[model samples]
Target: MIIQAVAHRGYPKKYAENTLSSFLKAVELGFSHLELDVHLSKDGIPVVIHDHTLDRMTNGTGRVVDYTASELQSFRVKQDEHIPTLEEVLRALKGKIQLNIELKQMGDYYPELEKRVLEVIEAFDMLDQVVITSFDFDALERIRQLSRDVRIGLITFGGSKAILDWSLEMGATFLSMHYAFVTEHYIQRCQDLGIQLMAWTINESSVMKQFQEYPSVWICTDELEGFMDVLEMSGSI
Candidate 1:
């Protein structure tokens, strides 16, 4: 089977995370799987970003929830790139790549985040090309009730029977976890449930080589170009 390579935060080393340019560069580099995070703006628009606070990635300060979508756009990332909305990212990469959108949970924020995100996905006609994932299992369960066909993944930090059970109960198609948690038994358990495994942040060539022997369907990483080169050299792609 052909393992998928997901660009974590869309080639962040070269471009700003969650920006249109970053996603475009991932596509240009031949990455079909793109992983991103989503948070609702104060105005109820779903914006693509990873952090709850804007201080680290953007020119703005304070919580990202404080700004409207338009206001958030004013903040520059790495000088030129501005924060992008989920719709902008969906529009830019809809046909070119598969998206794994992580729904960020902020207390009393984006009460309808799952619904809004599904609306955007439906609007872009990308329901088949996206997998909604989160550490919030409740959100995933709610999403399942809204749309039975939407693909969802359970994001976890460890490999355990409890995690597997939860994922299976939620009808998750993928189990996304930290790379260190992936083991032979973990792979088998996921496989038994017909769930594809996705290992995250595997940047080391040695670790990548080790994971290549496993049955993970996708490997998410920051070093997309480097990992791709390694895979090609090893004839694993």
Candidate 2:
């Protein structure tokens, strides 16, 4: 089986998560897919970062939405890397890799965030190369309303049939779930339903070996090298 390893947050083990440098490194390391998060800045621009707040990942100390894209860039991630606008990431990785852009929303959704994100993807002409994902069902519905051609994925922590049904209802082609919840039965169900499954943030060698039996499932992980090693060990590379 071929292992499809998606660089989660662009090789977070080596570089600061979600930074352009990390993304470039992932690309350079021959990863074909990368996953990143998107949140709207105060000025309505989509910026690349995982959290609603910048306190953990950067030198800043407040909500990311409180600052404009320019202001947010002033804060350094790991004291050197600046927060990247979504456009910057798209421009840099346009042809190099496929992107899984998660519409990150906690508590309240961003104003017109789905529309704005679509606009950016359209501007880059990357609708075919990117899949917009979200844990928010409403946000995914909003995305469907705006564009029919762009692909959508539902990010869920639970491995329930209801979640799968809801994904089908919304015409989502992909379902991203936490790796721990994924089972052989679950993989078969996804395959039967014609929906692709992405196992998120998987780093363990045992889990990596287990997933190798199912070539249809994509593995999203921070340890790109570790996944590669597993592939090599199995002579599947």
Q: What is candidate 1's lDDT per residue for 57-116, written digit by digit as tens?
A: 988999988899999999998889988999888878878888899999644456898998
What's each prediction's TM-score?
A: 0.95, 0.96
Which portions of model 2 miss their true places by more than 4 Å? 1-3
User: Candidates' lDDT values, in order?
Assistant: 0.86, 0.91
Q: How far in Å is the alpha carbon of 55 misplaced in model 2?
A: 0.9
- Each prediction's RMSD to truth: 1.8, 1.6
Stretches of candidate 1 off by over 4 Å are 1-3, 106-108
lDDT of 2 by residue, 1-237 (tens): 323678999989999999999999999888878999999999999999999999999989999999999999999999889999999999999988999999997536698899999999999999989999998888889999999889998998868989888878888889999988888999999999999899987899998899888888999988888999998999878
